[model samples]
Target: DRGAEMEWISQYPHEKEILLPPLVGFQAINTRVERKTLVVELRPSLNLKSPTIEEVIGKLKSSYLTLLDILKGSLQAEALVGPSEERTELHESKAKAAEELGLQRKAHEETNPRWFNNALNYQEASTAAFAIDAKMATKSILAEMKTSGAYTATFGGYQMHKLGLTGL
Candidate 1:
């Protein structure tokens, strides 16, 4: 049987305890290399992909206050007509801010794995220690949010369901 392969003749595969994090909600292992090491990854999964902060914020803003957006946009358009020097200074300030933000994001990304979301694991573990089902806790929170009614008005439904549980 293939079970013989589990005991490698060379280097032991489990010599290094690789922790497949609960992050990204691993649907399937896409790749396996057998030489001197083992590496696992989710090649093409939506859960593995994370929308940039800018993209998520933009999508949320667009989905939430759509009518207000049109009105505010028109107002901003009318207000955009300003003194040339003032506009030039504003443009320069925005450019500088954007550059700074880019540098900070780059630095953070160097140490992070596409926002792997290890924070949620802490709370889930804590709840588990207390004998609480994380799923039921999430449902309770969703029900409370629904009763508040703001979540339904914002993203329709199911948008916030698996947020903390999965990667994206």
Candidate 2:
């Protein structure tokens, strides 16, 4: 099998094994919607599986709900500046984006609670893509610009939609 060279090439198969999951895991995390726009060229090198139609729909629904919740939290529309103000601004930005993205803010509130909750969990998981070691050095600053070069690729916008991003 193709794997025969895998062991033969290295005495430290353990090292290879250990490195394997983290790399795959990180790629899984980095290849989502929000992070995609910031990590363009690096995207294809990750060799991740593209989400299928059903998977895409599921991702979209959950992301839509998460955006709804964040929007609900930031209706005040206050100006968020500096580190202390960043969190509030980010929340407001996310909420505003959801509105612009066709999330149907009013109707989202009346939707099934169970489905909504599930979407929140999915959003959290997808957000981890930015946390991978490959991204640790540049995620915060790069992602903030709404132009980390992540979306230069065709799949970027689609992935972002899956993650519930709208106005980026």
- Candidate 1 minimal-lDDT segment of 10 residues: 125-134
How high is the lDDT of residue 155 in model 2? 28
The per-model lDDT (C-alpha) reads: 0.41, 0.42
Alpha carbon lDDT of residue 147, candidate 2?
Answer: 57
What lDDT does candidate 2 reach at residue 135? 29
lDDT of 1 by residue, 44-160 (tens): 223436665665545423332343333334334433546655554333433443344344334444333323245563334233322212233444455556769756423223444
lDDT of 2 by residue, 1-168 (tens): 111235546778765432232123232334334654654223213324855445555655566656545543433242233455446444445445435433454555455534634756445533542222112222323355445565532324334344433443
